[model samples]
Target: MLQTSPRCSLYLVTPLLSAAAANAFGEIFAEALEAAPVACALVRFVSGSEAHAAAIVAPLLRPARSADCALLIENDVRAAARLGADGVHVAGAGEDLAEAIKRLKPDRIVGAGSLSTRDEAMTAGEMGADYVMFGEPRGGAQTTGLASLVSLTERVAWWAEVFETPCVAFAQTIEAAGTLADAGADFVALGDAVWAASSPAAAVRDAQSVITRAGVGVP
Candidate 1:
């Protein structure tokens, strides 16, 4: 059975970080966690070996656990397993996703993203993904504009209404966080909207407020 929450919550995504950058962002990440309740955090790394990724994940693990946040490693199932992360966020609903589920299910989270069609999302859910993420930029491309946002919101609504698995909707801006939450996202993912802000902690607080207000009485 899939787990569900009473209301939408914040899901944070890190910018692609190198080892040095990851070290620097650790403090900021802790501050954001302190500011509000974050459901999960995806630690993305610049293209590198698993060892390099592990190095970055090791330090942040403590802070994430301290804050009661699920720490997910992006696109590196082995690293996640070896490092004892909460789970792995696979980028597509293909063999990679299936393998992650096979390897990590019943013990760890295995979320699927980069789904381009409703069928793909359904496939991910059927394959036992912990959650299906929509509106995340593919290949590091930026997804912006009102049209894209509308499409994402619609997708999230469709999933929330029809599926048991949770849906994560990526918001391009802080303002969009509430919109996504009101549209029925199980989790509103904030990337640049929080990391790029002047104060990430404050941004997290703002996101929390909006999500709380929008999620009021949402079934």
Candidate 2:
């Protein structure tokens, strides 16, 4: 189980780092971590060579490590083992959650994502998922719009009331981050909004502010 404080925190996702942008992206990511209380980071590679992605992720891991943020590779167990990542995030029901637990257990975090239903999320918990993520973009676009945000917040609130397993609610905007926190998310995951902001660090700081507000007066 991934024990976290009652207060919600941030979980950052990379903005598709190509091999050429590795070094630069590393620098930016490190700065973002310094700007807020980020609980974890999911290294997402939309489309690229896994080998190249690993090569880039290797150096970036140092920043996340230094900041005490758990670093999880997206959808690749082998790469997690090879890169010595903190854990692996298996997306969708298609991935073998059992096998992933078998490989990374007793040490690394094995989180589940792309879960659309309560049944799938419950199954993930039963399979020993360290945590289950909700509201994350499926097929890369659905979660960005406004409709998904409302649905995600409701799910986070529902899960928080009913389950002990940690829930990470992906927020497409800083406003959504605060909403999720108030609704009782353990961690709010930030996506393109952070990277697209004029100042990524400032964006994180802003998100942190929202979460802090939500934390107040909540018993």
Q: Relative to the true structure, how large is the alpha-carbon lDDT of every model?
A: 0.85, 0.83
TM-score of each: 0.93, 0.92
Tell me the tens digit of each residue's lDDT in model 2 across 128-152. 8999898775445654222476787
- Report the C-alpha lDDT of model 1 over 74-122, residue by residue, as the tens digit: 9988988999999999987999999999999889999998887888889
- Compared with the true structure, model 2 gives a TM-score of 0.92
TM-score of 1: 0.93
